[model samples]
Target: MWFKNLVLYRFSQDTDITAELLEEGLSHQPFRPCGKTELSSYGWISPVPGGDTLVHQSGSFLSLSAKKEERILPASVVKDAVNQKVEHIEAEQGRKVFKKEKDQIKDETTLDLLPRAFTRSNITRAYIDTRGGWLIVDASSFRKAEELTSTLRSSLGSLPVVPPALKQSPAATMTQWLEQHAATLPSSMTLGDECELKDLGEDGGTIRCKHHDVLADEIINHLNTGMQVSKLAIHWNEALSCIVGDDFLIRRVKFTDTLQEQSEALNAEDEASRYDADFTLMAGTLGEFLKELITVMGGEEEKEAAGWETKATVTVEEGVEEDAPF
Candidate 1:
């Protein structure tokens, strides 16, 4: 119900997204357990446990989950098996095992070990804000978020979604905020205890501060030395706190006790009801917060006109008789 991190993607205006369309598209790739010898399997799943639907709707928000099952096979174990086989073959035949044969042995070893490997499953939850045409993923890194998006893209054929673009860079805006010590910041946002600064030089260095004042003299001295803020921690209207990175990543998100208490006050009788209600509240709150953030950063960057095409060149081999009739 709660997300610890946020990775945002905005859908194009032309994309006709809806709950029914998502449910149908996602049905084509429902969650399946990993098969033997397969490294991983990813597909859509229900966000609520014991729920049958792939898409959970709460007002304009559509919740979705992607489950990934992966087999754990140690590389060292495969390498040791390959090496032992190579040594045995070389000793018995009195000949060196070349790279090609050794590689084959490694592949065989890996396949042989895969059946015995332990399997683990992980679920990544995300929601589409239909009102804003935004896809918000609960992931710590872009790689993890992309895994879910990639699967969703494959399911839907093509997904016209891209990361949020801002008119002003987060680093420069945050640096200016620190320089003015909350004077230039919006009334809804205030400085938190953590920050990360980097030197804008060939041999760049990083300084990360936690549990220290971001506007303290020591930190200001570093800034005076031409260091720029790469990440800054901030509290948003006393409802949420998170670290916003220059790369547009929101990390370490914590919802305030007030928000939680409000959710708890709903007093749902079952897990499904509670999840739905809590998600609705969270999505509504975050929608407003993100809008305020976008405004504070001077609004979103203008996107290019749609339906542009790039010309591609193909080179055929001189010896090949292109699609010759037999």
Candidate 2:
């Protein structure tokens, strides 16, 4: 399956791992449905439904999926049940139910409802680029990406990775790009039809536009009025298009029709073959796009920052890893 969104992370350059090794590590906590009384369950699962393998290898990329099943017991329902029990007890015993009893009743209600409550399940897919030292997740939510990384760390005992940080903040760079009217963008980069602009103040207003020309005078007027571009749609090298946000998260990713047609030319006869063909093409192109993206954003940050650490360059004599090139 193609990834609709991307939340990218960087792994240490020296972090050596193989598909078999990753599969063995993930096997420590395989997916299992939530038990009758359990409220939730989280574990590793095959990216392909009904597949037995935990790690699916396609050339240099390794795909993994995390499954999370949660029981849906609304707080309002629990409160209603607890209130009913509290009222019945007070009415029959002729005594007011205090906070302690009310809390106990609430807990009891939750446990009683847990077994019968409906459940919802979702799968988060991600791929590890061993060659480029990147972990690319197909989730728009940062929280979901962190959850997958957390589970991976728990399973493997340690995972040294951090989000890609750039020397120039995305907001500042995008703001400048908008001010320039897309005339100074890097090679093969072009403005799209959507953008989000917001004032700099803490409580300032935000403006979102879609199907509107970003270089039009109307949008430029907002820039002249001190609003900054927080999110912008851009097409990269004719391969894919996505909206890059100030938070450095890429959303609304779509591979170009030409690229899709190229993958289709493979003429895969089975599901596995088709998946492998598509992924191989997607990962190969995405890797190149990221390198140019990092360059256009003023390259990766050189030092450690508040929320992330840059991979350090180490010498072979020290038996340490080199800094990630991209």
Candidate 3:
């Protein structure tokens, strides 16, 4: 810390000020940083030749005592203190934003603040107080939170007005209608200006979307189908060829819902899983009716099988015998 205490005696290059001890090394003192000092004692040493010899003036040395413990903060503390230490600045920025005032500061270009105090990382959500102290934000500590509460009201409290058409019509879904007809939904809608989509240049379209392009189609299809939820089976080997839609969402659809007791109708060990779902409607009602008909007819019996017992048909007419030659 010798350098910390070491005084810098620069030649005071200002025209308006001059005093003692400012000339520390030359023995002829000059200007000072703090205050004027008495010219306590003076002595003149004359040069041999000149008309008036130069005077070597001296006095009590003016002291400029440094008040700080160190001239500069250590590098690491500087990095952290500016980051977390300033609370007053944070209070100002957050408070003014709540009121509809023109005076407001954004906490941009800085990292999100952390809990430490006075680490001056460029990343900031902070400001400087009148005393030059940094004020930081503590997200976990609700110290100055009355201000944040009202400002946060604009986050989730309001709902967008779905068009009277979307709300009233039972046929069109929220996703489909929004896709084909956003212009009629509302005009310049806003959550206090936070959520409004950015307008592109004159000829271009709006640059934001409520959801991904692909997601809107998928969700619309799910809502339209008979309102039956697709069942997801966790067991893999128990799976049938019944995966639906595409990729992972697909699964076998069967008509029978109850766990059926094993019988000739469902012979294979793999077919046991078909009993897990209801095959009744799936046969002809809903799930893949055309495909199910093909599977039932694929059996070697080829002809239409008898209906579930007791519906035996009476003979329409006895078959006439063809004569054979001996």
Per-residue lDDT tens digits of candidate 3, residues 55-130? Answer: 1111211111111111223446544544443444557666422322211212220222222223221110111111
Residue-by-residue lDDT tens digits, candidate 1, 74-94: 888898899999999999999
Query: In model 3, which runs have C-alpha deviations exceeding 4 angstroms?
Result: 1-147, 150-183, 186-211, 214-216, 225-326
CA error at residue 154 for candidate 1, angstroms: 0.8
Question: How does residue 115 of candidate 2 score in lDDT?
Answer: 94
88-160 per-residue lDDT for model 2 (tens digits) = 9999999999999899888889999999999999988999999888989887767777778888888887777
Q: Rank all candidate structures by their lDDT, best first, as comma-separated numbers.
A: 1, 2, 3
Who is ahead in TM-score, 1 or 2? 1
* lDDT of candidate model 2 versus the reference: 0.84
Backbone clashes for every candidate come to: 0, 0, 36
* TM-score of candidate 1 to 2 decimals: 0.92
RMSD versus native structure for model 1:
9.2
